[model samples]
Target chain A: MWQLYQFPLCPFSRKVRLLLGEKGIGYEPVRESPWLRRDEFLDLNPTGQVPVMVDTDRGVALIDSTVICEFFEETVDKAAMLNGTAVDRAEIRRLVVWFDSNFFRDITAPLLEERMIKRLVHRTAPDARALRDAMKAAVGHLDYIDYLLDHRTWLAGPTMSLADLAAAAQISIADYLGGIDWKSHEQAKRWYVGMKSRPSFRPLLSERMDGIPPPSDYDKLDD
Target chain B: MWQLYQFPLCPFSRKVRLLLGEKGIGYEPVRESPWLRRDEFLDLNPTGQVPVMVDTDRGVALIDSTVICEFFEETVDKAAMLNGTAVDRAEIRRLVVWFDSNFFRDITAPLLEERMIKRLVHRTAPDARALRDAMKAAVGHLDYIDYLLDHRTWLAGPTMSLADLAAAAQISIADYLGGIDWKSHEQAKRWYVGMKSRPSFRPLLSERMDGIPPPSDYDKLDD
Candidate 1:
């Protein structure tokens, strides 16, 4: 059996979980708060990050969300998320990086730092300026998403791909933290609603981070 | 033909260049200073980052270093950088991320900020403490490299892979910025020297960023 080490709020971990769900891969979810930098977890992944996949019986451990995604995409033939030609795959991967790096860095990361990490680790109030900055960045990001949806059926191309999963994962976390303002972002909101209603994303929306409550419309499909 | 848009000191671009060199795929190097955030470049990539591969004739723009490397690996298949089974490839990619994200964050990014960008963009002096911290981090990173070399021929495994390219690219930039100290990292030094002697790496070592002189032994194979 496979073990997935992750916390409820990590976007990268969520990305892996969504991919696993799509691929019909089963694994035991191991709750791990990477901020604690647990020694055992650090041993599994020197980076001290979560969303680590380990199979103790096989003595196999996969670290990094992207690495894990690529591994299963290679090992399992079902639900090809990185689909299409080499050029198409390149475009898919490009957006994956865009969401993973740019979207995370600009929006999700800051919200986590302010809303989640500061409250949990430091036991302090989040900076008002920082939260505002993240939410503002989210507006711009949603604008970019709207721009993308204007052209392609999906984020990357005609078919669904890892890009959708990556974007949804980050957006989910941002929404959970109350960083996203969905007003005036009809296209992005509609796209996100489609993503939120996915079977793979349902479980993620239902889960809550301890001591932190999401906005009222977080899990509601009608919102 | 392809146009690779990157500045000389950009480690991600160097990684792509190494892979292209090994695969015998040709690309025209187009100078791009991402920090400047030029209008045309921003239109090409909203991320405002280097290592963007474009073919105007085909209207294809491959952004992100990993995306570019994977594209060529899939399309060309001659050099086969992402070799081995799924697990092995995962290990290789994990290390690639290690160098690209962690090493770049702890060492290269700070050093570039202190030594290069402060001088170029801000016209300010580098913080002594920041330089000290980056060099200190470089020691730990080089120790990790030594540990990896103790167990395997290459950083990832038996053969030269994109992992080596990623590590060497970051290290080369760090070395050029005078952030790396080679006093105790004998194993890593030897491995890096081997990487330096490769024909692909030779051009990178010889190229210098304007007004920033590298250390005297920066290009020497004897180091």
Candidate 2:
């Protein structure tokens, strides 16, 4: 049994969950608040970050969504999840880092920090400058995504790899926060619709925060 | 032939160069100024990021250092360079991400953004507040690195892996900027000295910036 230490809304955690679902791996999800780091969680990952996976069978713990996904692909013998040759794997990893770095800071951070964290903590209102910057940055990233999607069915290539799951995880959170204006990019919207319809994505759509309701079409698989 | 598009000081680019050297692969290094978005470069990577690898034999272009390293490891079948099993690979990848994210922002960013970039552009003096925040963040990450080094010979584990190169690349840049205090973390410094002495690290040590001299003992390897 694998014990996954995670937070409800963290995109990194969500990516791990989606990978597990896609691989059909059964695991117990233990919700952990990153701010209030537990000793056990800290032992697993000294960084005190969420989405740490404790593989009880192997007696090993893994942190970082990219690492976890790669581990799963390597350990599981039945199916090959990562696409392409060495070159293809490299491209997928690059896209994963792109999502983690550029997308997180540009799109997800702003949307979550403004539309979600502010509501949760009753802190100062979201900074308009930051929000605008995020929106502007997101436009460039979305355009890049549109270009990538145009080249292949998924982000990395024809097959659905961890790259797709990593992207969907971030986009799903943005969608939950009402950050995405889907109508603006028709191709991106279509790609997302296919992602949302995946069996691995069903659990993500039903995810709800304490006081936040997902967009009207969030639960619609084909939306 | 593998053509590497890189900047001299970019840590991400350094990682790929180090990996190539370690693997005994010959490649042409093309110096790219990130500021100048070359048309051919932009066509290769729409994102216009540096450290793009053009493998003429395979007829593939790969961007991002992490991706390039993984690709190199997979394609080159010699001594196992990545180190260990699937779990170990996961741990190594996690550490690489940590260096790229937390360490780069906390340690390298402060030194580069404040001290180095200022010299390059003659901008406003460094922001004391941001510098302080970066310093504080560095203390925690350095402590974590120290702890990791204390337990093992390298950042990831026993054998020198991509994780070590990833860390060395960032720390080397910070050291060049006179940002790192070698005396503070004895273990990390010791591990770094070994990394600095490797044959693959000679090119990095010989590198000279136009107006910047690294610390007095920068090339001493034994430091």
Candidate 3:
């Protein structure tokens, strides 16, 4: 059995969860709030981040979402999740990094920091200037996503990999916060709609925060 | 023959170069400035990032330093570099990500952005407050690296792996920019001195920027 320490809304954690589900690997989800450090969580990951995967079978704990995903791809018996040849793998990895770096900072961080974290944490509130800057950055990121999706069926290549999951996790959270302006980006909207419908993504779509409600189409996976 | 698009000073590019050299792979280095994006370079990588590798034999291009490293690990002789099993490989990959994320941002970026980029691009110097903040961050990062080194002879495991190369690449550049305070970190300094002495590192140490003079100990591989 695998034990996964995760935050429901953390894009990185969600990406790992989605991969596990896709591979039909059962794991125990230990709910963790990264901001509030628990001793047990710290023991699992001294770095104090999630989703940290503890493979009880191997008695090994793995940190970093990309590393966890790569581990699963290697250990799992299902068809290789990484598509194509070495070149294709490189492309997927590049997109994965891109989503983690650019999208996470420009789009997800701003939306969550401004609209979600501020509301959840008592002492944290959205800075007016930061919020505006985040909005501008998010728009720029979305524009880039739109451009990427315009040419390819998937974010990296034809088949879905961790790259799609990484992007979807962030977009899903942004959607939960009512952060996406989907109507303006047809290709990205179409790709996301397909992504949301995957069985692996159902858990993410069904996740509801205490006070935050997702947009109307959140549950309509086929939308 | 492989073709590497890189700048000598870029840590990410340097990581790839070190990996290639360690593996004894022959590749031509095509120098590029991140600021001056040529059409050919843009065609290779829309992101216009350095450290892009064109694999002539395979007719494909690999981007992202970590991804490129993985490509070489999988394609080249496994014995020459990147040792260990599946779990060990994952551990090495995780450390590479750590160096790329934690060390790069906290230490290398501040030093380069402040000490090098400012002067090279004629931009205003980084504020003292920001540099101090970065130094604090670097100290925290160095402490973590020191702890890792203390427990294991080499990062990730007993055998030297790409993790060492990654760290060396970043630290070497930091040393050139006068960012590292080596006296404060004895173990790190000792490990780096040995790394710098390897024949694979000679090209890196010998590299000279047109107008910049590295610190006194820059060429002292055993310093």
Provide per-model DockQ scores. Answer: 0.92, 0.73, 0.66
What interface RMSD does candidate 1 have? 0.5
* Model 1 deviation from the true structure expressed as Cα RMSD, one decimal place: 0.8
**Which should have the higher TM-score, number 1 or number 2?**
1
Off by over 4 Å in 3: A56-58, A122-151, B36-43, B55-59, B78-80
Q: Which stretches of candidate 2 lie over 4 Å from their true place?
A: A37-40, B36-40, B56-58, B122-124, B127-140
Q: What is the TM-score of each candidate against the true structure?
A: 0.99, 0.92, 0.92
Extract clashing residue pairs from model 2: none
Per-residue CA lDDT of candidate 2, range A1-223, in tens? Answer: 8998886679999888888888799899888877666787778787788888887877988897778888888887544667777777887888888898779978898888887778776666777787777767767777888989889888899898888888888988877877776657888888888888888788777878887788898778667
Can you tell me the DockQ of model 1? 0.92
Cα error, candidate 2, residue A93 (Å): 2.0
For model 2, how does the per-residue alpha-carbon lDDT over B6-111 read when each residue is reduced to its tens digit?
Answer: 8777888888888888889888988886656789888887668788989788798888887787887888876456778888888889889889877887788777
True contacts kept of 3: 0.64
What lDDT is reached at residue A111 by model 3?
78
Q: Residues B14-94, candidate 1, lDDT per residue (tens digit)? A: 999999999998889999999998999999998889989999999999999999999999889798999899999999999
